[model samples]
Target: MATDTTTFKHVSYLWDEAKAAELAGDEVALLIYRSNLLGADLRLTNYGGGNTSCKATAKDPLTGEDTEVMWVKGSGGDLGTLKRSGLAALYVDKLRSLKNVYRGLEHEDEMVELFNHCIYDLNSKAPSIDTPLHGFLPFKHIDHLHPDAAIAIAAAKDGKKITEELFGGTIGWVPWQKPGFELGLMLKQCLDENPGIRGIMLGSHGLFTWGDTAYESYLNTLEVIEKCAEYIEQNLGKKGPVFGGEKIQSLPKEERLSKAASLAPVLRGFCSSNVKMIGHFTDDDRVLQYINSNDLERLAPLGTSCPDHFLRTKISPLVLNLGTDENLDDVAAVKEKIAPLFADYRKMYEEYYSTCKHPNSPAIRDANPVIIIYPGVGMFAFAKDKQTARVAAEFYTNAINVMRGAEAISEYTSLPRQEAFNIEYWLLEEAKLQRMPKPKPLSGRIALITGSGGGIGKAIAKKFAAEGACVIINDINQERIEATTEEFQEAFGKDSTAAVTLNVTDAPSIEAALANTALAFGGVDIIVNNAGISISKSITEHSIEEWDRLYDILVKGQFMVSKEAVKIMRKQDIGGDIINIVSKNSIVAGPNNAGYGSAKAAQAHLSRLLSAELGGDKIRVNTVNPDAVISDSNIWAGGWAEGRAKAYGITVAELPAYYAKRTLMNEIILPDDIANACFVFVSGLLNKSTGNILNVDGGVAQAFVR
Candidate 1:
């Protein structure tokens, strides 16, 4: 490569002193602030794609003297929301000392074992694989990120020459090398050659920048990345459609959901190259454009631009045999082609492994496609679980962004098969996977809660989410649906759950919502049939219209939802759980409430019949009956309370206290109390439990079951 001295550079910094002040002086606090700031910009990195670290002084364990320590981002920490506890601190001197006794290639696994044993504080955490890189560097702070602009420059054919001209000798370059003790040694060599170098660009890898202070490190990264961005913008110049001659593959989510759901099971089975696998669908504008483009068949198979992306994305994705017009009618065709697809993909992967297997590298992981792109319909990521699947999705998204920017400048180029294999099979990245926490009991399950606006249903949604279930907040009110959806996403994650506007009584609406949930979350695992309406009227005074409306929303609604869920669950061949949130009046007679009592009674009976019939299929059915949940119930606020108050010859204001006193324990049931019993039925904690009625009425003898 020829070194040129003339290159135009333009870079800017977004620094806020107030933001820095928010994080106290603690080393972890400063690191957290820096990590969040770097992660805030998708242009810098996306999701869990970057890492940050700092060196500080800490009290020694054996002696009272102070010693140097390195606090690096640990294995499972997310950069965007990094906290003080997310950082793991280790003895800087001790970590670098491992290089002396470390055997060349075979010792990589032992090196990581020793790295964990050198923690400065036992209470700290298991240090990350890249801990040695940061510890070996003689800097207070270090940052490594997969920025789009930087990655585009690093993967280019003329990366070395362009970087030399752009940095003006202020930054050094390290050619593509696998990450480990060797890579750390190479970076140390770059620093020794170029004293006071701002950063180093790794070919087809990531960029590493360090500084005496966190602010300096952050600023240098921003400026250097901005310069790369400028170079691409200047050279790429005017461009045609990023999708080549193809148009955006924008399709209505509803139009494609049912088809996606119907075919997800087949694809999931085919792509599963291990003991377990999950499928997730995503149709982000960019994703759709990439998979549906005319150039997809040519460019997508090229591979990832960054080595760090290999662990999550693998060397190449398994492109399904569907095009822009993929539909459910093709299930038979898909089923026929799926076997050969897997056979061919595995054959290719086996060939690659045999051809490119390095003596030092570990055996190739299962040759499954972590990513699957189906033109028009959208893209799906297959992983061991939902969280890992989301990570693959984020990696794929970043890969496209880099390619889009790079191809415009020249051609999108990435690491070849051999280098990709090294990183994918690296023991360091493998250790990260082995260290992941066990899945929660409800992991990979989906729960749909009706009347979830603000009541017992909403409480159930929140509780199920805590147990690792993806929640679908279904309600007729758009405002409530939006609010509840935001709350679910905040509690879980952006992709953990979805919300749909639905009227339970409407068959089409219920079908659409079920399809939406199935498409987004794969399929339903738990159905909480809690949506209903209450009308307080004496049997003689209640009109036929009242009975019809109550049954329509309560009895028929639950039936429709359960019927739809059973179909999907049966097809999944994975037994499911169904919980019906019935009223205490279902069995216990209540005064002046014939309509609600009769509907709830029918619902409770319906659950028993369904339980008896579905038990053969391994589906559990149960009911939770609560008496008076006075707080946050829409039925109470929607005039049912006032009517009941009038029946008791009391004001609505006095009804709550009266109901509280009526309970034997004087305990007014809250929405969460009902939520607790509802989750018991939904969680399958009682695997043998079926046709059981759990009550939540604070010891009301009339509501007690036999």
Candidate 2:
């Protein structure tokens, strides 16, 4: 199960001997210990996919007597790293007694209601769907999982025969049945008939193992699954390609990253209608091997090895191969090709539902594909944000491995289209979406913060991410960007931030960074032009190179970044926000500050010009003039602070107060003050306001916008 080929890898068997010894006989502790062991394995059960349970004893508050209780994994709890609180305790007598009161439970929902109401402790959580299956089994410990290898055998047409041969009668087989009270009864009947059997394979579903102790049950699962894995390797190793498809080698890493970076945003725009999604790209060797295979198209559409995956991956991927190596640069052409494919994909999904849907199935959900595979380039997965997109992408990556394993063992077979439809439209998955908290104002959007390695740029990046925008940390400093991006990811969550090295003065460098920004989080929807430098010198004293270098970065550099963003924003048709970081020097001239002041002043007016030009295209352009915002700012790092302090005839420590006292409000402006002004523009609080200068220099009268 820990093989390189297996997506579900068990890193190590770790257990706390002290804790185990402390509660050696306590069923709750044993269940917690064994559940953690199983849940920690991604290959054993994906995040919260499977459940575990055990029978325990608890004191009845009213009766003052030790009562039998069943501890099961609570609803919405993941098995990996599950805590004792994550398990719910139910009175075993009360749970088993329900069987007599309500025989032949027909509906899945009602069974859930019964389980929820039967909790022995008022403080305990609700029970999982499989609570009864564990409660009914007379064993002390029970474990169940949707292991990919086990499911590959269990979901097969001749799964029972295969299970019989693989386990040699050590495990029992139960036919497919909806998981409810009936399945619980069926399993009870199965174990009753075969008293010596160590486990049971639920055909077309998963595996269940039991023992008198937690260790016995856990070991049974590992041993049984390992046998099944060996069987597949021996049998499927020599098999020919079951699904015939043309072999296509993917572009190398460099080519694929470039190509994928360009197309991901376009695909995001294509898939999105109401809310834009972020895109994540991957060309892992395994993923590339699968995508580059001759049987990708023929194999990918067969459905998931297990129905549970359908909830996340859908019935089939939205293949965007173009089936060629041609460039997909034209926005209109890319849309034209995708529109028809999506239309046909939706139609086929609808037809699949119509032809295969069960009568009790839920309504058809969104038809957009969760995973998009583009041949010759790589794969793109889209979601409301980067974390969700990457989750689905990783799942698909692991799934591709699982599918390939199946294909090699035999023809890659999958659950029927109908089963996929059933699981996807199930209420549990729907509830996950419905129960989600309301998104922040800028959720699902992306903002690129230029020069975010330190100072005001970093502050702006932080504020934007705090407001729910996935931030792209662009800087010339590789080390700083890496550290800052990690901090953002830890504070915000995976896919919350990205990092790219950018030299604004270099056209090729800027283009590559912008493409990378698109690859990381769809496209940059908010561009913060914050990177700049200051050189205090008189116009006459400023050498030609010094003047040109200052202007090239402050004025020309911003234009390059803005121009690239405008193109992407225009193509997405999703209106964008741009805030150019200028200085109060732009409003009022400063002595011997000609090089810095003139560059900022020119860029400030350029903002006004772009505002007029891009307004019709739904791109807002604005500028902020700050007199002093030196908190962690690198702009003053080039000996400019000491020179400016000398000009004021004061120490560098007193310069902040000097600038603050000069302003009308006498308020010391911090990096956060500048960031706030930018957020106002980005959040669209003033939609009718653009081409305006907002000063963050503590109310500077001389720098007033009027």
Candidate 3:
């Protein structure tokens, strides 16, 4: 039969002929292709919430023996961007052996240990809880996805019969089973029953397909899910509009705004924005009619579409009735009523735990619904933020559709309560929860300081080291290299930071410095392009040699360092932060320093461009423009003191006050003041703020009274 094209457009699929041809090929490329295919399948399923895996050969650590191992995707990874390390390698033989054990094993703790055992490299990321299932799959490529259309159809009454007819005999149907060992066993049975079946569709769960190659398995999954989607759309018709609660005309204006704000925060927390609050009321006339209808209880399940969704949206929405006053003051009363219902839900959950769990099963998780739907007020999906709330909503909506359809097909049957408990409380899943390394704010993270060993650069390095960032100190001063290294070691502690005596003007030296810094710190996370030499020559007097020298370090150096940093950051997948230290001269344009100002201006603009390009990766790039801060150490060495003294027709001693008085704040800008700006940019406090230049000249650049 020709496949309907409606769902096919929405579904991502590989042509059957192409997949079949690719599968009839060499194994290694096929393995990689399968991995990508599984990634693509997951991305299509639930819009990238799930992952997939496969078994491959790698050298065993203990025996140094070549062993077959199951490499599964790591936790907290998006399937679309999964890499080699994203997959954790587990001993395939060991996993298979564990599955065949006769004696009852301590499933949770031992399974957790087994998951940990797979993490042979401490530096490597942790594997997911579903790793065991991937290991159990006899096929080299396994695909798992929570397709919305298939689940919607499977959730209705007579779901089994409908699925049977839709997929025909080639597809095996397993009643909704909680994921993990029990589901694994059930699937294994289904596999045994239909040896030639292309895939398995779980009622009220999801779809699973496998193949000798990744392409076949992935294509099989797409074809099957597409068919199910087509059947649902053709038969079930479009889902009706979601009902919003009754309008609250009687609510106090202030209270209503507050209620909106409260809801806004919840949504913003999930979605990362405090925008609109879209609420659906269960108390709406249509909803109330549906609820009061004899079929209400029949439609309402205790919780969400799937157990894992509970982590996002709560078990069930709160059903509100219009009989009660819709006042913010009465919100407490609403919650009070919800308390008992939740209590009842918990009681049911405990009973399920008692029936389903083994005597040795681990503790049960707290039963709190991620979403609460009010009858008249509307629905609230609770989560850490709006993004999470939206994700929960999508998951629950898909689940509700599936459950509704499954109820239509057959009595809505989910995985047994005990099986759900096992999957929910599975040790393997828990083992995936590893603590993320705390951000250094500065330390160990690679930093490239442009004018290192000089005044501001030295001070910035010292401050960064004090805050914990490893320093890559660059300087044009070959004479001061040894002394600067000593000073850095003294301030940052031995081995805490390093010094590189390289002219930032030289591209080769800049590249080499970056390589050394990466080798020293494992990766580059921060770049401080602070090195710049100022010349007090007017445009007419500015020599080509002087202009080249100034631009080479001030502008070209910043470009080279930023370019190299981005390359490293992209590879590491840890977004980097770049701080370009420009000068107030770049902003205010001091006479006779046109070349210096022009270069710094270019550098400043470069920061903005980089910020735009790298923001998607979470890399922040910003510039710091500081007014003159005079120090005897800086002035005496670079001829700045004499030159400025000549310009002002004053002694070197008067130069400090002359510069300090220029600021409206009348406060002397110190190198530390500039370093302070660097600190804030690198810290996550300004995580969302990037591109713009931060004027650290004591409000001098504001063009206003201080």
lDDT of each: 0.79, 0.78, 0.61
Per-residue lDDT of 181 in model 2: 76
**Compared with the true structure, what per-residue lDDT tens digits does model 1 show for residues 584-616?**
899888689888898899999999999999998
The digit string of per-residue lDDT tens for model 2 on 585-625 reads 98787787888888998999999999999998778899988
Worst 10 residues of 1 by lDDT: 1-10
The residue-level lDDT of candidate 2 at 463 comes to 90
Pairs with steric clashes in candidate 2: 8-43, 39-79, 39-80, 236-409, 245-294
* Decoy 3 TM-score against native: 0.51
Instruction: Highest lDDT: give the candidate number.
Output: 1
How high is each candidate's TM-score?
Answer: 0.82, 0.90, 0.51
